[model samples]
Target: MPPRPSTKKPNSNPLKKKGPENKFQRQQQPQQHSKEEETPFDNPTNTIPLSLQQLLLNVFQSALVPNTSTSQDGKQDASQRDAIEDEGQLDVKPLIQTIKSHLYNRDFDSAFTDANEELLRAYALRWSASRTLGYAGVFKAVLGILSGDKERRGAGGQIVCIGGGAGAEIVALAGVWRDIVALPTDDMNGEEGEGEGEGRMELKVTAVDIADWSGVIRRLDGAIRSSKVSGSKRHPAPLLPDGKRDKFSVTFQKADVLSLPEGELKSLYGQGTVMVTLMFTLNELFSTSMAKATAFLLRTTDVVEPGTLLLVVDSPGSYSSLSLGKSEEKVERKYPMKFLLDHTLLSVAEGKWEKVLSQDSRWWRRDAARLRYEVGEGAGLEDMRFQVHLYKRL
Candidate 1:
């Protein structure tokens, strides 16, 4: 029995077959062959060049410059001030060339990294400036509230700053309050016979952001404390000749703009008149989902009392999309300025927020000029466009 030859024969084909030969299988084989013929670079990871990496790094380093103010005597010196003032004054040709070179060198990863840093820095600086201006305006409005004449102030107000990174914008707003509203009162000597400068004016500000970003938060906290200490030491006299101290209140808290906590909102605002600002932060929200972003805005608006103001400042350039490139072929797509504006405007409208004021594009160009180059030619002012909108609650 053991010596008997084995009866089993090896099967010629192990693969499943519908028939001896099927057209579908034959067709699939050629398609597979054609796919194999394609170059490895067709894969996304392989196609990205090394040059892009370097470009991204350079852009990011450029953005880190403004934060340097923290290390430099805690106050901007004349040179630093001049540089900041002239931010958007220079040509960005050098920056473009540097980025182009990095891309040509196939360092895409580095280029993207650097670009993200630069974008964050740019956003920080822009928010700082805009916050300063708006704060000044709001402070003036607050003064009107204190003024015996009713027409100057349009109801007492509260301000909520969203994505209030590092609190630079908030600090700047506080500075404006100290200067225009606080200092002026201190200058006036209290004397009933002299005149009626005898009352305190108060304004409240609340800053909110999603992440801890402890470094920024700490720096801001220190700056605020220092400002207050400096003001107290420098001005012993009351703002009003009547020996009254004008009160300016500021509260900083961690919060998620997408899903705001109701208790935090009530504590910060307390039914007082409100104004909201989403400075350079809407883009992050937009990146997640435009519909979701709009919903967040709508929800925020719904929570606030009627007649509140919402200020939105965002870059209107196809820069992000251009960087991401095309979806199908991985080719770069040049997005026109118009396309960016249309997209941003559509989002705002979708949120059901009506635009009260929209600034010209030149402001963004000015901001870009402020960017300084540490590694490569910095992005020029002309390469960017920003639109600021003030939407009043209906």
Candidate 2:
């Protein structure tokens, strides 16, 4: 004490200002932190094989003109087929307008004819593909969160698409499963490569729709099987092992999903992880009748097992107008799609469904410059802004 008194002050530092005035300044200084580590789902890859898109266009054209080619050889009939296909091509603008009018008039039965579906595919396949990317991103984000806990890594499950007969969900789910199986991981010994396929699980997609889209789904499945990993600048080589591509099965059921009996609904998922999806489908059901939609969901709550994941994606700010009563006593009201979905799923029981993720709007776009094929002016190959809600059955 005597030495300190003679030499220097005990609580003073020359490097830092010594006063009550600097007390707040010290707390305001930025703290040093180590850089954060990146996770597998940090950046969800949205690229699809160029071959898939090209094949899709071909399929659409062929479906639109079933008898375009009678020749046996491809080279011998290439020009003939092209001319016939071009002639068979319907004007995208008017076709889509007609379809929209039918939909608006609440005549869904007339809008989904075989020819109309093909035309719709030609006009909207790219948009659907873009939406698939959005869905895959959400799937990865959810799976990534579940992966943090060792016991909850069984997030890989069967994908049941309520009205995904157009085949976007098929492609998206298959690609996600392929990437997940091919992703490398560390083993118990802290080594990489061995964890690849350690959690390998087969994906089964059940597509339930009111239309006969089985033919289209089959063609898409064939295309995906034949799609090779093109090591291009835009789509780099995939992580799949040599001679291995995505292996999955798709089952299409042509029926009104909402009208399916509880036993049939329960039969859709046979154990294992089950992720049900309603992509661009729920709004239509609500537009038809909110009462029916509500009843269907409540029935689902009673039928489905726990640990099920329900994923809903639709246009942002989707609204439906309801008219009740007859003649002069009619009353009409407009309701948002998200509000109705939340009310139905979350309010069914005390804890029937737990909302895992919700996004009001997320933009998904396809860069025209990266496309391998030429796009027509009125093809409607634009971007999509969608809302996504993910729920878990408790």
Candidate 3:
């Protein structure tokens, strides 16, 4: 709704400024000035150190400056870009772009073939995390669920992160629960006497992915270890929350989400509410192949029951396989808004999901991240952008 105009009459007391004619308004007019625009080359956010930002910016120049190399299939081979060699020093932007081309194409074989696992790990740590996003606002948003609602606080559920590369968000999810579990009684919901004992099931954050990136398992191990105690609803009450001896805490599963195993799905969604996060997965998948992408979404829909929480974060370009120019052999597909959500929730698809929050932002300023991206005219040849859809099964 548009805001209602203010009803107050201007300066009936004659002390307030009403318009340009007012003394106060005239006094302030001279102080107003036009602001200069900033760019990566000149004025930057400087959230990232200037030296590192320059290096990162340089990588962009080195990668996109030319027509670039072609793969065996005659398409742009982002992976084979000149990132290493003569100086024995690495220019990571080129390498990241290459891996991304393969990754965005969903070609894991070429993406990981002879790839320096450690370097890729380093790239995720230093580049993807910083360049893409830094804020854990989403985690806090999720955690707020358990904080505000008394019914939800006692029903700790499983957090399953699909396509959890490097497990960055997975770690953040666990961290939120960790702090939640470590909270004092008053901090948590319920009357003054209510405690952890009030909750029957302990919260679990699981990282599901095809590739187990470096530091993922260890980092998850630490995060999970901090979320458990003895008897309080944990199965068999393991010594730690790592879920090592038994299934008690965080789990890292190496499996393709397109056809997830039924046994694992049942275990996760069998008795309690299950929270699923699809972070940039649909974008990458749909960009490469639409049929496979639909199949994957269907598979996820098949598993979820009513009351399941799903958070989908993707790009419209990927969601629709956006092509800038006309293609000779094929045409790009344009999906309707919330296409994924509608399919997953429609009666024909089995799961009936309810839209909780759906927002599309353009040139949105990502909190704490220096970069900004917009679709259409505002976007560059390459820009990191996002659109979000939050849902819950009916």
Candidate 2 — which residues are off by over 4 angstroms?
1-106, 113-117, 123-126, 143-156, 183-199, 228-247, 324-327, 373-377
Ranking by TM-score: 2, 3, 1
lDDT of 2 by residue, 177-272 (tens): 554454434121233545545454555788888877776676556544532322223222232233445446678888786677777777776565
Q: Per-residue error at 365 for model 2, in Å?
A: 2.9
The whole-model lDDT of each prediction reads 0.40, 0.55, 0.44
Candidate 2, backbone clash total: 0
Score residue 75 of candidate 3 by CA lDDT: 45
For 1-394, candidate 1 gives per-residue lDDT tens digits of 0011223321111111222222233223211214544322112122212122111111222223422322112233232222121233322344445545665775543433335433334433333433333333333333322343343243445677777653544554554444344444322222123223232235566777664434434434333433112112233211111222235456667666666566665665567645777665665565544455656665666577665667665554313334344667576445443334334433533443444334323221122232232322432212223444455555
Q: What does the lDDT read for residue 196 in candidate 2? A: 45
Q: Name the regions of candidate 3 deviating beyond 4 angstroms.
A: 1-108, 112-116, 131-135, 147-149, 179-181, 184-201, 223-248, 261-270, 322-331, 347-351, 362-385
TM-score of each: 0.47, 0.69, 0.54
Model 2 quality (TM-score): 0.69
Give the C-alpha miss distance for residue 337 in model 3, angstroms.
Answer: 7.2
**Which of the numbered candidates is closest to the native, going by highest TM-score?**
2
Error of 2 at 181 (Å): 2.5
The positional error of residue 215 in candidate 3, measured at the CA in angstroms, is 4.7
Tell me how candidate 2 scores on lDDT: 0.55
